[model samples]
Target: MKIITYLFLISFFTLVSCQGNAQKKPKSEQFEIQKTDAEWKNQLTAQQYYVLIKEGTEKPFSSELNKIKNPGTFICAACKHPLFKTKRKFESGTGWPSFDKPIDGGVFYSADNKLGYKRNEVLCAKCGGHLGHVFNDGPPETTGKRYCLNGVAMNFIPTKK
Candidate 1:
């Protein structure tokens, strides 16, 4: 009986270890590409070109949509792809634009930021364009996420009447 119980325990642990390994994803699978400076320049706008391509951040509260409380869709400034919906917008008080969730699979996350602060870096899933970082400290009742984005990296499309 003692030997049988030890074998059962080992088998259970092995199954759990295999399950964990199966769920682990490779780093390459997280992001699609690493674009060159010229490639990004050719794809983004002057403002987007500066922020996303150059890794620059826009001034807080400078975005026209920062105070906009109307229904709208936020698209990638580089590709104009729909990324976030008005419903996900929230006042995160982080000074930059914030979103609780992204529109479906519009964005992809990867390990980012080299400031010694670990954060999830968000990017335009379609074109892999840089958007910003996402933090866990956000409004409750939702995903508890704060997608702090650069205003220059996005363009707001107000909902049509």
Candidate 2:
């Protein structure tokens, strides 16, 4: 009887601790723009809704912006926070649009435990929208990092020079 009681208490505490870790999301105070689910749903397309709000990944090589080489800036689809510049873009050959880095403090990082592994998630600091994941596999010359982004999560604004 005592053994059974001890087992139940241990299991309860274990479950509670797991739940606490899962709910440990970044606070809204760190971000500038905050919106309810209804507001974001209305502002974004279905794909944008999935990638930005639901933290989903788009199909690889499916983004038209991946091939673009024009001088411009890519802004967050949700809040128009300028994230990456054309110069930072690179052909990672990973089928996703990759950038060496993001504009200074334009995005923030969060730990995503999806896909059965831990990964750093990049999000717009302004809107807290999921942009994509960052990887260490990138050109060794620059920042030695790759910002693997969902193109649908951003909008490119070409600069007229």
Each candidate structure's TM-score, on Cα atoms with residue i matched to residue i, is 0.73, 0.84
* Model 1 Cα lDDT, one tens digit per residue, 121-159: 888887667788888887789999999999889889999
The local distance difference test score of model 1 is 0.79
Instruction: Please give, for residues 69-136, the per-residue lDDT of candidate 2 as tens digits.
Output: 99999999989999999999999998889999899988999987655468899999888999999999
lDDT of 2: 0.90
Model 2 residue 134 lDDT score: 94
Best by lDDT: 2
Clashing pairs in 2: none
